[model samples]
Target: MPHKDTQGRRDSTGGVGGPRPQEGSPRGGLTLSKPSQRRTGRGRAEEELTRLVSEARLLEGLSDSLRDMVMRAQAYLAELRTAGSTLENLAGQEGVEVLVPIGAGSLVKASIKDADKVIVSLGADVAVEVDVEKAKEIIGNRLAEAQKALQDYVARLREVERALSAYRERIRSLLEERGLAGGPEERSK
Candidate 1:
């Protein structure tokens, strides 16, 4: 229930009330004013701040997850490069012979088993090892870029959280120091 003063007006309940004369307004002046509607404003600001804080925490979690993905991508790229190098070396051994023409714009096929077939196109014949390594390098680079981008996002979210914290603190201090809702002693008794 809202308290009321002797004037039949709603007391200092610190919430919305209908239009009323401003305190100390001259009598018989026919002047009336409505109380400023700030409760909704304050509530909206608090909700926004809470949303920012939650988003910041989510970003932090995403950043951590990205770090793991980056490491795994790097490892996979290294493994692919190593395997490509080994294959190139074995293809150059005595058991490996160029059965077909080994030149640009040509197709070469090596028959290893009765049903196993390996088709080497012009590009593959010339740069099979390099292509594998290049692909791995590209994937690893992209993963690193993604990790850095996620970290940047997390940092931006943290800045927003810090700003919200400052705003909340400022509002709290203002309300406390001003004693807007009666003084501490008055409320206690």
Candidate 2:
């Protein structure tokens, strides 16, 4: 049983009518929760579905970003491999004509006057002159490291793809259960 106050306010906790509790009417008068505040079972399920769909979209964005990283890592690995190959081919070709890139895959004939030594960048705007063999070794090590990084990126992309796949399946199942399989896109298509 609840109590009423002078202003006719009801106390659901059976005290002097002070403030209404969040739910219930005064001792079984009616289910007096505001219609907007009242959540049906179906409404809660729909909310869950909405939340899942949003999470799937978020995961999809993450997957796209991971894919871009994988592509960049692959391109970097290819460039490192190409540089290593060029260095290996120049190992014993001092004072000979060689094709060198002017820009954008365009090569011009150039003479290797000093192929015995080369300037190797130690990164951060720092470079040191080293013999051809040492430069090649350094490039080889860099190539290996780049290859490993590429592998790591690819592995992470695969993991993201797998998670994206699972999310897609779950989203599909949820939609099908709600009779919204394929959603509006399918109908429009």
Candidate number with greatest lDDT: 2
Stretches off by above 4 angstroms in model 2 are 1-27, 31-39, 183-189
lDDT of 1: 0.53
lDDT of each: 0.53, 0.77
lDDT per residue, candidate 2, 92-177, as tens digits?
78889978888997999989988788899999999999987898899888878877887887788788778878878877876777
For residues 54-137, could you state the per-residue lDDT of candidate 1 as single tens digits?
665665566566566556656655654554454444432544533555778586867433112223232544633234345445
What is the TM-score of each predicted model, taking all chains together? 0.34, 0.71
Model 1: residues with Cα > 4 Å off, grouped in runs: 1-49, 94-189
lDDT of 2 at 186: 78
The CA lDDT at 83 in model 2 is 75
Best by TM-score: 2
Determine the C-alpha RMSD for candidate 1 after optimal superposition of all C-alphas.
13.5
